[model samples]
Target chain A: MSGIVLPRRQLIARAGGLVAAAGALPLLSGCDAINEAPAVRKILSMGEEMHRASQRALTDRDALAREFTRADLSPVFRPNGTRLPEGEAYAAHAARGFADWRVAVTGLVARPLSLSMADIRAMPQRSQITRHDCVEGWSAIGEWTGVQLSRVLAAAGLKDSARYIVFRCADRIGDADYYESCDLVDALHPQTILAWALNRQLLPIANGAPLRLRIERQLGYKHAKYLSAIEAVASLDGIGAGKGGYWEDRVDYEWYAGI
Target chain B: MTDLPPAMPPVRVYRHRLPTRLWHWLNALTLLVLLMSGLMIFNAHPRLYWGQYGANHDRAWLEIGSTRDAGYLRVGSWKVDTTGVLGRWTDGEGATQRWAFPSWATIPTRYSLADGRRWHLSFAWLLAIALTLYMLWTAFGGHLAKDLHVRRGEWAPRHIWRDIKDHARLRFPAGEAAARYNILQKLSYIGVIFVVLPLMIFTGLAMSPGFNATAPWLIDLFGGRQSARSIHFIAAWALVAFFLVHIAMVLLAGPVNEVRSMITGWFRLPPAKGERA
Candidate 1:
């Protein structure tokens, strides 16, 4: 009992020291030099990895994103990030009703294919009412109709080495075209689609007209609107900023935004 | 002088336990991070709604926004020009920024939804796991039944009313009476631990898309995802209020002794009236 009573003082002191260390981290992180430290970055990355691994452990690999009834659809589905793509190429495609636009699926595939809008629409299509969860703390339910991306990947005969799918979009934010990528696990999800229609109508200009990748399990940013091309790659090393997505590269958004 | 009667000092009692102290401090840090990061995340939308869905065109129950001339905060039918405080304010750099919650109250101190989310989700795991472990430890370790649970005699309305009256007068129990928590303290602890914390954790998980895939019924339980978000915001504010009241009570009771008790698990119990120190 005497030993237990004496140790309390030491316990308090040790706890105080640990708390002080944790408190100092934000102060040090505020400085550019300290924030850029490999150890600090590694710790931050480790937190994200832990979260991703734990969430993955909880759910099945092919678990579906929740589907809702038509009555659950929002009165107006809000468009996030860049509303429209600018440039002559996108304008030319839009002007011709995207008739000339083709989604080029190349790199590490047995048969590289340039699929026209007509060709994509002619494929067996699926329509579902799913909630679009924005990373910015809002959600809206909308109906989407499209061909499963896995079907397209199968049609192109993805090479066994294809580990990730990179989406190169026509939308430009700053100097670079907005781009995003996902692991093959997400790519092959049953509900992941290259949606050409919303609410039984042609996709609106403000809502990724012509085509948008609706990877339902992730946040709105991962959906990658105004899609121009798809590339199958074994690694994300050489992609734009190389963190798997535009926001992930520029703003340190986690690549695996399952939540 | 050596033969004179000796003076008695205040009695020291072991009040809080070590695990409780550890849990309290950890919760303090986690809650602070969660609240600040949550506020920053809220700044992204600046609106709250009821039912299943809401957007720019749809009506919202609450909104914080700014126009060219002034800022406004609206809740239900009531609206206030909260300019220069809530909806719009100047930051450390003297640049005007529009936000629902000011820069001082948010993580990053600047607009970055991505960073805000990263902090919020990371600390959420800490809060959830810690609370779970703490609850389990308190229950199985006999702390709950021994200290937190109100006694049969104390449950009487007269006794409860007396405790309330004493608290209203800032008259905390002393000496032998102070060895255990008062009925009021136990009740508030129960409210925060079992009610508020669980609500916060559940509503938070309800808002996550990935979690929704696993448990869509949670969203339905809260009426909708937006409803869950609204409830989360409200509960966070409730927690903040609870924290403020907790700190105020600590100060009122005698800061040094109260704080030391929480920190070191040893408390100098206040003497009863006409009793020797």
Candidate 2:
């Protein structure tokens, strides 16, 4: 078309309009489509009530799930997704005990920093015992110790634009890079940690040993292991499929797998 | 010419989107196959309690065979499976049927487990992601709120009574009335989608460790591991029931119309005057 440029004010207005549109998305539904009808409306209302009840059933709003004894561990916590990473760089890191593993924190931050394992451990730490629930219909509980991700993000000095934090991992599930993203609310949750140790020892190779994630509220898949890089973004629209998960992207895993 | 109340026609609008229709039918078929396979797998162990292994007794022929490289543990003496474990010894009645092959040809339970995990896990994603995306799209387009907005007509006592009467006569929504799932389909399908599926996924995950930080509350809420198992089983059965009712309703209302709507995304309803009054 023409080489005319829109005014900067007009551009900002359009962007603001878009954000407002997304925020008010729930209102768009006619309110008579997904949840109402003439026949079973009463029963469905009951279903809605049951859903609210289910929410209340989740207790310990502040108290974290217990950290368990090593004896309470699974016989074999099978490795998920990538047994070993694809890239040569990850292979080298694997060959070594990941002793020199440096996690890069960049994107939408005033201070972009890379921290060593010791640097991470030296920072504030959180230890919790929680059960891991894999989609495979199995459950196991183990103790995890790591740096709380919130502190790291705080250290990086998040810009006003930051909305989501993306974890770029060494593991690859098919062609796309295995990554996970979470909103600021979840990233700042107390239980969410950048775990470096499992069962009182350094992380094991099979179990995302050196460094992994522990987003306690979501499903096992959300607790991405084999951590390498962390990036903060304003929106996930540019990310893979606009879905904020590895399996959620490759297959169709739900991004919100909150129990 | 336009005096007819601006065409405030009695024609009704369907609540379910085309994608939802597709998902419902596809999910039904896959879930049926999955449930069947799940039952067959369950038959292999038939362990009563949750996560607790059952002792191979004389009453049933279910055993969870553990692999032993040490060669010290020998429970039975007979021909082995392909995995080279041991013999297929019967507990009581010598019932030799196992979901897997005999020891000589039988691989360890891990083989079956790992594969089942892959399929179940992957398919669960399809269900979840599709639902999520549809919800997102619907939310943006205001579809969810609109359909769920129950007018006073929907909740009145008379409406309920009329629904009962209609159901008793084996008469259901037809033509444009059926085109829009007369209040009943809207509510039930939403429940199946929003309530049941999420709970199923949550309870399933509550039983796993690799991918989640375990919630003790879930354990307590469901009355421990065994109780969670019971809830999960019951929820699955409820889904199955919903499936049966849904199919029977489709058969009654018109399967060809129902199936075509799902697959082709075009719903054909009989004329309004021809529909049951």
Candidate 3:
């Protein structure tokens, strides 16, 4: 096996040829081709997959994101992505202090739920001060208190077919409704929360008030804010543009934004 | 004129080896991608902060921001409006766009943080592997001792001062001495290889949340991700300065000779004056 390894130059040449071939295959795939050269597509997918696999393999699956001291918290945690979700429906919910708000949990679960804000707050609470690293090159620390998503899934009793957890948000950017998803691993992680409080107070509207998904290990975008519903599915094929998230659909943001 | 002897033949000596040449070209490409993509990434949050956390509402040590009609550059309390150049600018077709660095400086030549990251991260992997191998080869092959390492004698004030003075006068050693690196070259190379590159790689890893979980100590060593980011940006600029100075020296010494030596490994050393072949 060692003797069969080609020299670096030969390996590069062979890879380049394969990349060119991959680039040419876009014609057959049409719009599903990710709007990039197949070569780039290959590299991006391979890189993301390798990153995900390596993280899973090399690190403890339950290893938590670094927690910070209260001193480390930003004076005011910045609101990222869509601040206040538009439309009268969300405004009406906000007006009544989310008295009528209900998170409809459906699909591939034995007990589908329509849990309210009061119900979520009533569940076991976990609060931790953690850093939020934005993909856009800034980081801020904030204290978040909410229910663990794993407990919610367990309450609903996940069916064997449920492989992914998708969050549908009320915020709309550019023309589409915002959405994001995660695999079972992150969805069931101990730190993953349905956070409704920040800095010892109710979550401000700008910071995904009422509720937001806090998948601590992922980038800020994956923490989908203004969350309205949770859906369990076996495959992401039918999700928005078949890529999982709003940003992932619109742009080529990786579905598995683990970092 | 008739009494003057024939000019001495310039001796050809091996300067950059194959590994060095390979590393040079690869680094050139990778660093270019890293810098351009890095600039694009920076444009997303054109602000810098100290300590562990910073956001829009928090105090930023530095920022390049734009209003609806104008651009401003801020450092702590100081603010400078730099319209049509930074914060806001016109592209090639005269369309206005907001950017800290111009579009020409970024990858894709347009605004796309996602694409910038793809280019940056992909090349990052390539650079890490290449640099690790190059460092190993340099250390094991005696290249570090033979050419890169500054000798104890060379560190003497007089010797260092002479080298600096010679450099200021655009004077390089000739003949046998020219074949080996000067003290300045040795020190700068050492700084870049040992200090800058490693810092870049470490700070980069510190930014990755995956690495943070696997090696949380790295983030702590750098005083959190935001500090690591600040250091990374500062180091990148330092590297840019090093690159500019390196190119300037190459141009001063003789671009053709210096560039050819890096490419082909056979450097033609200038003959000593008043010496016959």
Which sections of candidate 3 miss by over 4 Å?
A: A1-38, B1-7, B67-70, B78-81
lDDT of 2 by residue, B1-277 (tens): 5543343334434545766676667777557534543443343333323441112222112223434331111223432342322223321224443333232221111113322333344455556666677667656756666665456688887887887788778787655565555566667867877788777776655553311233566665555443465466568778889988887887887788767767666666654553333
Q: Which regions in candidate 2 have their CA more than 4 angstroms from the true location?
A: A1-63, A69-71, B1-218, B221-227, B234-277
lDDT tens digits by residue: candidate 1, B40-68? 88888889988766666678899999988
Docking class of 3: acceptable
C-alpha TM-scores of all predictions: 0.91, 0.49, 0.89
Residue-level lDDT of model 2, residues A1-259, one tens digit each, is 0001112322433453343345333332222122123343343233323422443354333445445566656554545545566778877877787778999999999999899888999998888776665443344567789999989998999889999999988776545667888777678879889998887788887677578888866556777778889999999887887877766554334455453
Here, model 1's chain A TM-score works out at: 0.86
On TM-score, the candidate that comes out on top is 1
Which is the better candidate, 1 or 3, if ranked by DockQ?
3
Fill in the DockQ of model 2: 0.04
Q: Would candidate 1 be rated incorrect, acceptable, medium or high by CAPRI criteria?
A: acceptable
Question: Chain A TM-score of model 2 versus the true structure?
Answer: 0.73
What 10-residue stretch in candidate 1 chain A is worst by lDDT?
A1-10
Over 4 Å off, model 1: A1-38, B1-6
Fnat of the models, one by one?
Answer: 0.52, 0.06, 0.53
